[model samples]
Target: MIQKQLYFNNNMRQLIKSCKLGRDWKKNRNFHSYKAVQEDAKILVQPMHDSETRELSFKKNSNVLIQDGLLRFHSKDIKNNF
Candidate 1:
């Protein structure tokens, strides 16, 4: 395996190395209507799209749905929410 070296002992570098890199809304900022806004789209959009399985949106800590019409449910236990 190829090893990568870190240039600085920072929090961001640590997160990236762990394969758990994510955006922190508190530190980063963006512009709004002629001014800087406190609202962050990353809070809702980025993590929700990236972390879960493809082509589906689920609520916080919710179970993955299994429909009787889908083939994927045949292999999976329908009772299990995850």
Candidate 2:
């Protein structure tokens, strides 16, 4: 449980900071097939709705705050930004 929260917290912090800087995050890129994609910076992350706290990475550069497992976002469409 601690590890889970730690991962969540760490990712959350990254997300918030990225939002402030105007970055977009990506998750599950299957980089094995595309080596070039690995060079991209990570920007945002969230637990995919279908998973049990597994992260679905995102790419958005802006300030986002997550409190008590809830997120406050500034972007409209994160996928487009990535």
Candidate 3:
């Protein structure tokens, strides 16, 4: 087994690791001006879905839809609107 000494504690190391990854994470700010702003197109833009599965797709929450470069969805009060 290989043992390594970490400079930072577990939580500090995790925070720095997340910060390093965050540098590469970019948000699409020009979403409103997107040419094809359809749900299907939005889904295609992000390869976060499984190609084999025909599910509409979702993020952490089931009722939430992450599209148009934004997190959109109805609140519990307006959920019945759909």
Model 2 lDDT tens row, 2-64: 122223423432221112111333323443111113223233334323222222233433334
| Model 1: how far residue 68 lies from native, Å | 3.0
Alpha-carbon TM-score of each model against the true structure: 0.15, 0.28, 0.18
The TM-score measured for candidate 1 stands at: 0.15
Model 1 lDDT, full chain set: 0.20
Clashing pairs in 3: none
Instruction: Compare the candidates by TM-score and give the number of the best one.
Output: 2
Q: lDDT for each of the candidates? A: 0.20, 0.30, 0.23
**Which ten contiguous residues of candidate 1 have the minimum total lDDT?**
11-20
| Better-scoring candidate (lDDT), 1 or 2 | 2
Q: Candidate order by TM-score, highest to lowest?
A: 2, 3, 1
Candidates, ranked, lDDT: 2, 3, 1
- For candidate 3, lDDT tens digit of each residue in 20-68? 1112122344432212222222222212221231212222222222433
Q: What is the lDDT of candidate 3?
A: 0.23
- Write one digit per residue (lDDT tens) for candidate 1, span 6-76: 23332111011112111321222222111112222111111221343312222222222112211111212
**Which residue pairs collide in model 1, if any?**
none
Task: Enumerate clash totals for all models, in the order shown.
Answer: 0, 15, 0
